[model samples]
Target: MRIRIRTKWNNQEREVSLEDTVSVLAFNSWRIGMQSLLEIENENFQTDTQMQRIAVLEEMMAFLVHLLDRIAYSSLNDSDREALVSAFAVKLADHVHDNARDFAKGDHRNNFINKLNIRLVDYSETTWANIAQEPGFSMGLTFGNHIADALGPRDKKWVLDYIQQVLMPEMVKLFKQVLARLGLINNEN
Candidate 1:
């Protein structure tokens, strides 16, 4: 039986047609999108600077979040959770070394000792954890926070209810809420 599922993001409503299995379609869409990323030829090693590497990592994580948004919460089983979590770790391990490339921007020139330092610094199991621990990597953690998905079946109901409700609202209300806390802008405007 085919059914239409409606999802909204950024004030846009999308309707996806399900052919008997919603999870089946979700899995295939994610797989195809990631596969295409791999096919693109990597630029020179020289071009793979720290910023570029972080952007690449963000792209990968963002894709996962997008995938989760599509799939039904009940469909995510223990096996699926394990696979997805491990996928993040494995991808982190693969490209962590890419940061060794010389700085492609700024005045920081490539040096032998700096290159060695990048190699010697062990990233442990969680790069996100490492980033969150330090003040210097604030950008990384802020982005990492948005991209990280730790939701399981237990937390799914409230998230889909409360969090999804927030997304349904207009952006102006959300922007004012953020600004009100910082005291930069006032509601009187």
Candidate 2:
């Protein structure tokens, strides 16, 4: 028998099927994968095992909230930034739609997806607004100043270069590894 899992985002309903004997962690991992795509762009973000778990949850929540806001304001003019956000939302929505079973319960499942949907809906608007208003929203200029202050003169340039190049790619790689371990990658079909 198959079980159905339903989630709603931006007032749209998405459903997925499960084998009727899947584990909860498996489902959460898929949900985490759908969430991770929003933050790091690529799945190679680096971190340790524990850090990876936390990052997955954090990034997923952040992305969900962000996407909810973008969907809500879909009528607004599209800036380059908005375009990027829309792309991410489309990708995540697709993933969720494709992998409904990974998040659905095997037995008389209840509450998990419903609770997550509620939380995402309730917090997305405020979270998006706060992130947009953040002082460090800009990349090169704002982050450059932050880098200089954080790294001192002797290593400022090198540190900034590392952050843009090495660190970001490493992080993406690590994220992918975590997703693999969590069984999100192989199940995508």
Candidate 3:
């Protein structure tokens, strides 16, 4: 989803600044992550309870955070990339906390953030498949493991294939489109 930014600067128009763009990207990431979670739920991915649902959503957010970090790597310097991913993760944490607070116990925001940090570190050790330009085999497997854990025993058989083939590819396509529209990346990337 595209975000509109309203700005006023002495009646002179300027391109959306990087800060504003980062905010918009983070917002869109959260929106997209939520949508993805709903889609997965509809597919009967086993988010039967509120805690289960929140766990799935947290996994989705972590995947998105890592994916966004990878996408920004080619286009942004280290500090800028870190800032963008951090902001995106914070926004995701806020959304998760808002949605999960009543159902779950204790510090959802910090919990999600802390888990996200750990996920980022773990996912970082996995390779990025240059040929496919997406998460490598290990990364996708790891994400599948996370989803499977969140989903419990049911649907475990197909989770890995679905995540590696359907989920990750679709998310990459969506994020790339968003970044391209925002001029952070050209269409080719």
Q: Which has the higher TM-score value, candidate number 2 or candidate number 3?
A: 3
What is residue 58's positional error in candidate 3, in angstroms? Answer: 1.0
Listed per model in order, the count of residue pairs whose N, CA or C atoms clash below 3 Å is: 0, 13, 0
Give the lowest summed-lDDT range of ten residues in model 2.
Answer: 16-25
Candidate 1 local lDDT, 36-134, one digit each (tens): 223221311121234543443334334333223222123456675445433433333333333433434332222322432332232221223222121
- lDDT tens per residue, model 3, 101-148: 889678999999999988998899998966545788899888888888
In candidate 1, position 152 carries an lDDT of: 28
Q: TM-score for each prediction?
A: 0.23, 0.25, 0.83
The sequence of per-residue lDDT tens digits that candidate 2 reaches over residues 1-189 is: 012232222433343222211233234334544443333334233333433343234334333334334432533445733544444444444344344435442321222244334444544433222323221223223233332333345645555555445433333343334333433333221
Lowest-scoring 10 consecutive residues by lDDT in candidate 3?
A: 1-10
TM-score of 2: 0.25
- lDDT rank, highest first? 3, 2, 1
Lowest-lDDT window of 10 residues in candidate 1?
39-48
Task: State which candidate has the highest lDDT.
Answer: 3
Prediction 3 global C-alpha lDDT: 0.77
RMSD of 1: 18.2
